[model samples]
Target: MSDDHASSSDTTAATPAPRSLDDALALMRDLRARCEWDRVQTHASLRPYLIEEAHEVDDAIAQGDDAVLRDELGDLFLQVLFHSVVAEERGAFGMQDVAGALIAKMHARHPHLYGDGVKRSWESMKAAKAKRSTLEDGLPAGLPSLHRAHRLQDRAAGVGFDWPDALGPLAKVREEVEEVASLIDPATGAVTNQDALEAELGDLLFAVVNLCRKTGVHGALALDRTNAKFVRRYATMERLAQADGKTLSTLTLDEQDHYWDAVKAEERAG
Candidate 1:
């Protein structure tokens, strides 16, 4: 056969593989129709589980487990199909509609790749589509404070409503610290105005998060690493104390400090 004919013959003889998306959608549809548990579920009912699966995926990524990440991602994808299938039963939209909207959105966002439109910033496109008047309007209210602060700063910065340089945020951090200090009694070292102390402390943390954003560091990830480090050091101290026939609670402050210092020394030696 000629090369073109041979290619065509090969293409015709090849068997088509089943698509995972289609299989998943079929599974969702079947569950929604027959399974009592799935049939009773609604978008509102599955909200918490969707959030949980997303966090599980994040945890899996942090643990550096590809198998767990893949499994968690599959669970997360199932949430999408589940919600779409639920909507389908209510005469709304289905997975195809969800996918089509996403595809359209991505194409619209990347006009340089798909159309004769000029490339524009993602924030600009998002702002144009957003109904809210403020930059921080669309952010979820339940987001962790640090993440919310980071995103809020980012949104504001996108519109040039930000400090000029790293120094600005660093200076802001100092100012916030001073404000927090003012909320405490100078002699007693006790927080006199609890409410004001809370607010000022929040401002200090927000400033630090902004500094993290400007310095190309993720505040949450930095905090997570610090937390892990603390846990490791504390556990080492506990093990050392146990070896010396003592408990951490039984040690004096100075003695505990000695073990803590020892742990730091060991870590540095390693």
Candidate 2:
């Protein structure tokens, strides 16, 4: 072989193909060193990807396909690897430190398994570690509003500040809806004080979320399922309309209702 060919072969042989987590870490370190886009990234710059990948994993899980779930999980892992590599570059810590910290936290939380102390609730254990002005003070403001509300309710429930049953939140939901309705003109359905409507709607949603929590359902996941259902049904309606040489917008409200009912019946029958 020519000298260039021999040198290229040696370079290729030096960097083995990744087969495990250690290899993934080495690969990430190499990308940070050599790839232009990867090299320029910091934890701050990649923050959005971290959140986006997590949501993608959520989507994949909702879809309930193992293949898609595995791919999305890997995408989420990439975000973890990216942050770990970035921190390593800054001498803050590396993947080892991240894994070690997690293991330590697990051992502390599950002392029954690891030996020494009894099992403790994760949230209560977390609260014990912090000194906060209020329960909400420790929560990140950037959490999705629905998730934030859910977490806030969870924290309150941790301190015995919860309704005894779903009925309480169900009643609160009705009250919030009534408060919201009071802001609207009954005759024309014109909403007065749009800001008040928005606030009342928020209250209504919070009450609904609380009800969902009391019912042992995650509000976010439940909403996600409902959103997906709506999209599917609407798409089916649109398809049915197209089959009749019309679009949903071209149909009268009653005609649209017919299509919606048909879709619902079809779904039920299926």
Give Cα-based local distance difference scores for all models. 0.82, 0.82
**Tens-digit lDDT track of model 1 for 1-270:** 122211111112233454677898898788777777777877897887788878878887888966666667777887888889888888898788998999999998899999776887666667667855876797988999889889888877766778878999999999999999888899999989898888899889999999999898889999999998999999999999999999999989999999999999998899
Write one digit per residue (lDDT tens) for candidate 2, span 1-270: 122211111112133344899887887788778777778877787777777778777877787876667666766787789888888888999899999999998888787889666876667766667665788986777888888999999877866789999999999999999999999999999998999999999999999999999999989989888998999999999999999999899889999999999999999999
Misplaced by over 4 Å in model 2 are 1-18, 115-119
- Residue 77, model 1: lDDT of 86
On TM-score, the leading prediction is 1
Pairs that clash in candidate 1: none
Local error of candidate 2 at 182, Å? 2.6
Candidate 1 vs. true structure, TM-score: 0.85
What shift in Å separates residue 65 of candidate 1 from its native position after superposition? 0.9
Poorest lDDT segment (10 consecutive residues) of candidate 1: 1-10
Residue 253 C-alpha lDDT in model 1? 99
Clashes of 1: 0
